[model samples]
Target: MLFTDLARSLPATIPFVGPEALERRMGVKFRARLGANESVFGPSPMVLEAMAEAARESWAYGDPEQYELKRAIADHHGIGMENIAIGEGIDGLLGHLVHLAAVPGDRVVTSYGAYPTFNYHVAGHGARLDFVPYRADDHEDPEALAARARDVRPKLLYFANPDNPTGSVHDAATIGRLIDAVPEETILVLDEAYSDLAPDGSLPPISLMRPNLLRFRTFSKAYGMAGVRVAYVVGEPAAIAQFDKVRNHFGVSRMAQAGALAALADQDHLRATIIRIAHAREELAAIARRANMTPLPSATNFVAIDCGGNGDYARTLLAAVLKRGVFIRMPGVEPLDRMIRVSVGTPDDLALFEDALMGAIAEVGRPTAT
Candidate 1:
């Protein structure tokens, strides 16, 4: 076999078991798909129209330079086009970053139970991962991560603003402090996948730049184009250039570029979808409260509801919910595993989840003393 020693040594791990795979395995389709944090409301009408129009030209590959889409993104952020590097998605960009920076046995830093795909990429590139635990309040601890990065002097340090799983966010001031605190030699991989859903003061200014900082954004979340796989990383030109040496120049398809460009142009539709997601998030919190579980404050398009029990109890509840035909998920690692996460959806979709929750609770019952 020609596999690298790294490849042979690593486990066959997938970051997520998508809902479709779950349905096939369980032999039942989900009544409401809320597990993946996808925007059930979907992309704007303009995006659909653009993608459909671009489909006719799909025989030719998308522009390797991604000129028009990159220009639009640059104008949106008031940044130079030279600072942007587009990829299939944030996941693909992260993989490229890891490949560019880490060699076998190099270290990377991230929060425990943060985005697993980043960790998967690090492992695939044969880098060692050093994890800092989340704060007791469930937010990713930037200070702790900074300290760890300083200690390890890692090749990359990963932090997701408006973080996944917990859906907690830090204000711009605090995040700025973390950014400044990162070791000079370490690249701060700022994953802002949910930034569009965050409050006004939650994100630092787009003009903020450092040689060691790279911020990633995607059209998947607030723009409602997850399936399209279009996202980009913004950084100083030198650091951003590293991706070009390694990235698949045409990995982003023509339809994806057209759809994302259209999505960016339709700010009105984006605002409306954000408003809708906010309402649904509130409803989700209300449902959690009704079930006597605690919903964490979220700045993103999902809510994490504490099941008021341990990991086992949460797992049982999640299994019950899935069996009731609603797809949902929980964090895989400890402590954070006490909650089940659900994405924002329409009234009809959430109503299904609400019903599933009640039935699942009825079936599983609450955890009791040993």
Candidate 2:
């Protein structure tokens, strides 16, 4: 048996290591798990109840069209049902978009340190990725990205507002300008996975007026439905229709649709969760300050702490936290990689982080060769 040439050439590493894998390796459960931007606050009571109710019907396959979820999303966003497409999550939708736009050797443009999942999709589709370095003063510079897209003439341009790793965001006006600057034929894939966690006015208004813009939102973050694997894309009807050609129809489970629908309906829970996340972010920043680290202002559920040194120092701090049974992550690229990213969690979790971080610094501060 033989694998495809693409699969053979691709690296064998999984882009992200789940917490379960870390537990397996360490042979202990994490004391304060906050690496993945999951909502520790958990999904709404209504969402859980809906899932439980749907579970009884698990023997049947999910609606291949995902009609109910799509319709609900469309109503919420004030868009037509045809303008929506649901999938296993934004990850799956991204893969389908990459395949639809980029043939092998086609170019794809993205920020150098943007979401890795989008880059992974580009690689999987054999697209050549042209990366623009993030703006030195701003991590989420849509203008810089627009310049890169214009220069590269990529078939797909990826942007993640309230970016991962850095937790930075671009204002709606800036995003609009970037959209305007893109070539008419270029596909702009905006991953708004963190948009729900972002403050009001942070995201662009829900409008499918652009032929090239595709916006993806997920239940994985603020909704606390990462395990549910439900996400949806909003775009022009014609643009969204392309997804039907490549998506795994029954990929989204019935439980996912039911749960997500219930989650959407429960605005109160979502509001409360967002409030808690905001406070946690502030608390984490305060902790970073006490530890002599700088916490970058974040609009997402995670805070990126400037370790005040190079990547090596950040890595040391991260390892120290992990050893202390606190799971966290950092940027994988240079410069940005100097900051350790910690997701917002419950007060108890933040307390654990503060203790672990202080201990780690103290341990690493021991006298050594100067």
Candidate 3:
């Protein structure tokens, strides 16, 4: 077998160990799938119908340009079709962007405990990564990160508003400052996967664009189309055009395009899901409090509950919780690893989490005071 020097140098393992994989390993199916930040509420009725309709036409390839879906997304964001580029998901787009931007030994910057998938892409592309720690309050520090960018001038710098692992967020003004802080040479990859579920005015206006700024949006989160696999990046035409150079031409399927179009067309359904998520987030926080854990303030659909100890204690608790058949997740790094990340789900799903949490605590006991 032959592989590139890069491929041979890298670890054979992948980052994700999904619930199905866990079930196979542990020999028990999870009762609640809350780890992956998927919307248990599911997609809108219209989106389902559109996907079903499109599935019947599966013999034909989807438009390579993703013309109509791109048009709908453009109209939704008040941007031109030229400004958007569609891909399999944010994950796919991240991989392509890394490919476009990085050479061997290029540097990429991101928050220490931010999205692992982005870091994975950067590493896979043979780029060195520089991580800035989250702020004292658990938010990604734009100022510190910008300073790092100014110093390092990495090929790419990533910032996710309503950041993952913590569900912390910054207002539009802060985001604008982040955009401005990027050095001319670096591409700021702004991930807005949770924007639809964020506080009103938390996101900068969609009119915002820059030559070195690429903002990613997805139908996976608020649209509940994770399985459908449609996401897009918005940037100046020149930057967005880079995807066309290397992207899988027909990666976004007909069903995905149709479902995303229907999802966007039904804003009411999206709004209702946001509300449901907000309510569930509160319930998750309350569950943490009842269990004597500290729930971080969240602007996203998921809540991060501080387990009141070090990473080891949190790991033990997470394992006990998993053994209870509740599928949840935690950061793999220190500091942030002390918090277990729980995605918003239906009441019943959260109730299962609550039971799992309480039982896990009973089984594992509280973390020893440090």
Candidate 4:
């Protein structure tokens, strides 16, 4: 088959093999599906109704300009419509952003193990990837990443607040410092997928904008719309316009647009979901502690439980938990891998996980020597 040299060189892989794929392979259904950071709390009831309405009108193509969705998003955030650009999801938008800001062999900097999907896109485009280690507290170190970006002067800098896998967060002041630290020539890719659930002061106002900064958000997390495949980016008009040059005009599905618009409108439902997530997060943390594991403080909808060992130990814990019909995931690299990353779930789901975790610990014991 004909292919670019980059395609020929890249490894074929899915960044995460989702639970459905696991179910097919294992020939068993998970009782509590808590992996992949998806919200078990579900979308607002209004969103479901909107999606149903959109489904009946599926004969027409979605608006290429994403006009209404953009208007709604802008209004929700109290930002100018010109500052927003909607796409399939943060995953798809990141792909477009990488394409817009980087060229083959150009540099892209991120934490050593932040979101792998961003790295996947960078690699697919043949970009040289740079890494900065997380702070000892397991948080993405904005200062360290900025220093590396200054030294390397990469084309793109990737930072996720309320980070994935770790679920740790930095306050707005620290994030502002990192944004300021980024070189004028380097585009800062601020990923805020979990921003909806973040504490009040953890996020800067939506009015914040910079020519070199692009903040990515999604309906996938708190809105419980991961299956809907819709998200958007915020940046100055000039930078936002670049997405139009390379985006799939019909990529954001009609159903997704309708659902996200409705989700945005239902602020009360969103608040309720947020409260549910917060409560579930606490329950998950307490479960971790009762299992003799250390649960890191989380501002995101998931918790990272330290297994008090290394990657192998956590991996063992995760596998045992999975075999017991509670699907959870752990980070890929250490020392974060010493912790398992579990998405918040309902009472039933959390109970299943609690039993699974205790049983797994009983069977596996603890992390042994390398």
- Write the residue-wise lDDT of candidate 1 on 1-370 in tens digits: 8998889999997899988999999998898999988999899999999999999999999999999999999999999999999999899999999999999999999999999999999999999999999999999999999999989899999999989989999999999999999999999999999999999999999899999999999999999999999999999999999999999998999999999999999999999999999999999999999999999999999999999999999999999999989999999988999999999999998999999999999999987753
How many backbone clashes does every candidate have?
0, 0, 0, 0
Clashes of 1: 0
lDDT of every predicted structure (CA atoms): 0.95, 0.88, 0.93, 0.92
Q: Against the true structure, whose lDDT is highest?
A: 1
Q: Stretches of candidate 2 above 4 Å error?
A: 366-370
- What's the true lDDT of residue 222 in model 2? 93
TM-score of each: 0.99, 0.97, 0.99, 0.98
Cα lDDT of model 3 by residue, 1-370, tens digit: 5999998998866677989999999988899999999999899999999999999999999999999999999999889999999999999999999999999899999999899899899989999999999988999999999999999999999999979989988999999999998999999999999988888779998888889999999999989999889999999999989899999999999999999999999999998999999999999999999999999999887999999999999999999999999999999897799999999999999999999999999999999999
The residue pairs that clash in candidate 4, if any, are none
The TM-score measured for candidate 2 stands at 0.97
Please list the Cα RMSD from the true structure of every candidate, rounded to 1 decimal place: 0.8, 1.8, 0.8, 1.0
Query: lDDT rank, highest first?
Result: 1, 3, 4, 2
Error of 2 at 338 (Å): 0.7
Over all chains combined, what TM-score does candidate 1 have? Answer: 0.99
Mind giving the per-residue lDDT tens digits that candidate 2 earns over 96-128? Answer: 999899888999988888888888888998999
* lDDT score for residue 204 of model 2: 78
